[model samples]
Target: MSVDDGAVAIIGWDPSLVRETVARGLRPVLVRDVPAHLRGTSIPLPEETEEIVVEDITDVGDVWAGLTRHFGERLHQELRGIVTFDEFAVSTVAALTSLMNLPGSRLERAVLMRDKHLQKQAVLAAGVPAAASRLVVPGSERIRTPFPGPCVVKPVAGGGTAHTEMVRTEAEYEALLNKLALSATSPFVVEDLVDVAQEWIVDGVMQDGVVVFSSVGRYAAPCLSYTTDAEPLHIYRVDGTGEDERCAEARAFAGKALQALGYTDGVFHLELLLDRSSDTFFFGEVAARVGGCLIQEAVLLKHDFSLAGGAVDVALGRPVQSTSETTDRCVATTSLHLPRGTVVRLPNSGRFAAADDIHEVRVAVLLGVNDHPEVRATTNWQGLALVSAASLAELDARMAAVRGEFIEQSLVAPTFGTGVQQRAFLADYEDAWRRLL
Candidate 1:
């Protein structure tokens, strides 16, 4: 029986969607100060009708136990259902998996999705088109696979494309293999580069092992180009009916994958690469949650349908409707490309927030902060710029305008010396002398 109102314990918070649900009147039993809780302190549980626990989902052991104990203590009796929002909520997944015996609900499929090698194997077994992939262990000189085979290599699990490399030649492949700091246990997954004509994301909501709502979002910019070149990335709802061939094909294929994976009552994001070679859909990757970044934010602001919100509604058996057609339009987000340089001067602050179409701009890499190693790649910029428009052209124009305004300034590199010596050195440099002396 449904109580007065159901409580949702988000496994993780900070996605902003979780906060939004709380704003919508759903009581979220947050695990106050997850960091402290993980450090072995008993978290104070809020006395509410429902208890929702949100924690950082990572492989760390302490968090696992803390979350596990709370779920067993609070949710074991009064909770209707527990919703996991964080990727590393292994304990939560384990608990749910043990309770419902549902594969998708427990996110075993998420493991397959996280491990590129495993994901490919799962798809291939189900007759879903996929690129050839293999596990590569370091220093196996017998590692003879034709070097430089238009392939990509990356870590077996985790987010972000860090340490991701493309090997087009034998020498580069060898260099990459040698460069990777691998142990006996460390392994990487190498995949044959697919010839993609177009790329799209299949976003959907699953209920009781069935896909209730599905939509296709086409990418206007290439993944490599936008990520590596620091160019703007565009993803918009495709202009077509549900019966459109590509749409139907993608839906059927994605639904099958979901079925095979045993997902139920959750949001799933799957990436598809339309192979130019044979006009087939090649699986790229998937996430058991909403796509990282502003995709969900757009859905909330533009369309009233919140997959995050819908998850809570489903937990309570509330009415959930599909997002409107008006939300189907061109949308794009650009990772603010702050190159490796000292921020000696910052351009006019007004110019940064000037564009009408630009929604948000955040500078993650600040003046005093060290340059992020991952952001060195064109695809891994230090900040993000979000923009939306009615047309792809407009989105592109607005993103370009925002990127054009920022100018990097040079500064004398900070060197380690005694405080007095450092001060003396600074006095010698004209810029530092004027600013500090």
Candidate 2:
């Protein structure tokens, strides 16, 4: 059965993507999970949608059955493309799309895309500039690589910054492994820690075997430089000029990565380093979906670009309206990491929030505020702010003012809890379960 180009099936739910998918002149079928806890907040489904609710969309079995049962007989014929916003579910969505013979990433390639170890292997095979890495499995003798001064430890299939650590010594490396106590099957990936003066992200749109458009973002501080000090949680990781030399280099790197990863259509968020020491660009990491936090919002506020929308357009084989080469405006996003513990009153934001460039203020953990917050991963942040300006200097000045006044009002020391204790607890539970089973 030949599929029509009028309807697109989204295997996951993202409000922005749903809205943009509809705007692109296509019918949307939202395959979403109706979680018991989140039922209180009714997500406004598009007026035109074929929504598929499941117990858990992240599970492959549930997603497969949901798409099959909900789409019914017309799935293969009417569904034009299969799309998803969930990072972990990307492979599952692609595989299901392939089974239905829809237009999307190939099942085999999609599976490899999610595996960080293999992704780097393919990228390196293509002569791409990426962090040198090795896969470590317990009791495996193939661990033959000289360790760098500071390296990053990553679980092979880690979804986000979870289980990721910056190991400064060999003891720390071994300790990280013992700390994880991963299931026998799970292995880990270790990469040379990137020496970065500033971290930048290339959020690009890929379609028709080419990168149509890309945006560059600069971080005020490295995302993974975890510290327990009373540092401001929300540093300005802002978007930069699209035509800058670094951005150009990043775009070239991204093209190579896409080809290597077999990504034909979708939004690709590529994180690479502008090596502070070497004055060179090196690949940090890559994902086949939109980047979390500021990347998406910055694009919209500055260039009216939607990474999620661009992705849908790519899936639908629609033309992309990528941003211009040079950007006259500057945009910055500050993530406020709230203190941990019970609920408390929030600081006064009446002054800084009133600024004109301060367009968006989002509070994720307002119900429960903490004075001494526990930092686990990137998800530990409490709130975020979006600011834009006409120039970099003005942007910095405004950001400094806001930081001094509103962003730093809550003086709480953050606690670093990278699941070390939690891992030990889980290891005990698993031991008990293993014996019982």
Candidate 3:
């Protein structure tokens, strides 16, 4: 089924990965415009990929122009597919595929997937286990809609867990709104909390209508751990042997949920909340793309296949298959939490890199000579460590080994004037400029 001659246009090409996740028979063409920092810096690119730089490639017309300009000489050979890593560009890629008669997703299904409320309603209507939610605008007359204790609020069209809040009290609800800083007309989703005990992520690749690859991984602690400062984020792939019960149950349940949500092809990342008492395994949301963080690496280590590459293969009508049925290995992705001012000393990761079990180590915060970076929500993690082992205990030990190497350092403030002077100045200047405008 592979398109042999035509090339596929990869919208929003990720610069971090030097090569395409999937090996393609068709030529790889990169159409990218973001990650503005790497403008002058060199990031790897595949040797054969046709690079076309354009502004706002997410715009449908811009995508068309970029693709046509690159492939116009070979009109007889049309594009095989259009794919995007940028979550917001999902609809635009689908639309362009349909317009150009390429093998890809339906525009309507992609749009429904992006819309939070509509997707929830669709799944609920299909009798899929889902949480109750309502759409609320920033300054709507119904802004005071009664959400009982343990409710949640989020953007109708947001990703990366930005501004997501759990409202268990009136005070918390008000504080969440203030933190969000929503405009008078912006849209949001307020939902009945599912009394979540634990949360997990299921990532897989689908070809045609069948799930070609699937795996389940659970967070070390509930994501709500971030509700307080003590908790950091940790996601661990579930270790499954032959006839693993939890993996089997999760796969069957997730497959059904994907069908109910009208997911037909490509890769999917589903976030599910487990509340065993009420027997509720309701999925909070689903994305028609690969999972973020160390998931791609985990998938590669445990299953020996690139989840991102498989999605591209499916998009181009190529065969996408899993090499193994069950895996005993587990991979852990831990996001570290630290004091928020200027970072004094980062963990020396050479020891971790030398360890066989440890897969990767990352320090997210950039250090400056005299200033600290602005601290956002839980999204602004201090660092990360990916370790692998056969059991939870061993995995935990390996992760601890990495953390143990770090020296305990604090973000310090100056004695007089604003402690972090440079950051404070930038923040104040931005505020004043906004007001001036």
Candidate 4:
């Protein structure tokens, strides 16, 4: 049945995806609060409309209680199923798996998938090549590694590269370890850095513990910079099912990893580093939900598949369609990650309206005068542009031109009353905005 006829509940962090799901016809009862403007953009409720609930899902307890309340009683009373795109859902779903009297393996497996340390252990035990990793628990700084160099450090349970640190030397590594506040006992993983030949992404749905539909992605830019940058940038490879050996190996490894993790049902997003130097595929990470960035959109446009919708179907024990034959003629997405401390303003966005390939320009960051954070300090994404190119080369050229024309011209020195007062001013401003919002 079409989503219009069926309602699904979405529990995830990314509000944008929640908005997109509702736009696609599935009545999304968001488990997270919707921004005011986004609420304004939502489709108006019909006279006989299906109810859509939006709640604050800042923690795991909130999610568990929310799901049980919705699925246990709400589903039977109204046709509904749970769909999620955030890591927190893994734990919530795991908890619900037992209480709901459903298959618990998928949820248990997802915990292993979401936890980098657990995932690495499972895959390594299966004989898959992976970077030597250590789960830096609280007060556990004396961790040793055989090949520690240019080690990668990332939060044990965060995505989008937030809080991810790269230590290239002994000094940097030691500093990072010291500053990590190992006393907190929070989980962080440090892994040996590998000279990556190519960055790739693979995703698909599994049915009854077997692979059904899958595709691989090639990143146009490096993962290191992609994770830690603001300003419109493109990082995409190709998404196709062709007779390429490299693609085959990457796909095979993805399938193997999913099976090894015992992920019986649901969407799996896997990242791998192809070491052409050794002709070996190294597991980077995996998410039980859809891949972050534009991969979710890319998957839909390139493969005519909806992992989100399929996931809901699987959770409801409904039938799912195969996505192997879907393909996008051409698609590209760029994160309009403007530089911090660059006091810039949005021009007549309609000026770029005539651009042939540029389909949509979304400003995630609002237009306002605020102190930009320092370099390496994380801020919310400024904006994103989804362009539809006629060809790959055209996509690249158009994105580069757009970046050059807009980001450069828009770059302006941030106004500063005084250097020392900047932090205090920013703090006040942030507090005001929070209170106002």
Cα lDDT listed for each candidate: 0.60, 0.69, 0.70, 0.64
- Which window of ten consecutive residues has the lowest lDDT sum in model 2? 409-418
Give the per-residue lDDT of model 2 (tens digit) for 298-415: 7776667777777777676668777654446787776665445343345555555677888766655554436443425655566667777787778777666665554356533223
Candidate 4 stretches greater than 4 Å from native: 1-7, 13-27, 33-60, 67-79, 102-105, 138-147, 182-185, 227-233, 240-243, 323-328, 342-344, 347-356, 369-380, 405-413, 416-437
Q: Rank order by lDDT, top first?
A: 3, 2, 4, 1
Report the lDDT tens digits of candidate 1 across residue range 297-391. 55554454677766655554555566555454555556555444344444444455576666666554545533546333433555566677776
On lDDT, who's better, 1 or 2? 2
Could you tell me how far off, in angstroms, the CA of residue 133 lies in candidate 2 after the best superposition? Answer: 1.5
Worst 10 residues of 3 by lDDT: 368-377
The TM-scores, one per candidate, come to: 0.75, 0.80, 0.83, 0.78
1-437 per-residue lDDT for model 4 (tens digits): 24565455556444444454465555666565455324444234433223323454544566556655655655544444555677656666655544555533345776787788888888899988898878775345365333277888877777666667777888877776677674434578888887887778888877787767787777665577554554344645365434267778888899888777888887888889877689688988888787655666666666777676666666666566774555445676676655545454554456666886765556555445545433232224565656667678778778777655556545433455557566665676678679998
Q: What TM-score does candidate 4 reach?
A: 0.78
Off by over 4 Å in 3: 1-5, 15-18, 34-43, 73-78, 142-144, 178-185, 241-243, 344-351, 369-378, 406-437
Q: Give the TM-score of candidate 3.
A: 0.83
- Say which candidate scores most in TM-score: 3
Candidate 1 deviant stretches above 4 angstroms: 1-6, 31-56, 59-64, 68-73, 90-104, 140-148, 182-186, 239-245, 314-319, 343-356, 370-379, 406-437
TM-score of 1: 0.75
Clashing pairs in 2: 339-373, 340-373
Better of 2 and 3 by TM-score: 3
Q: Which model is ahead, 2 or 4, in terms of TM-score?
A: 2
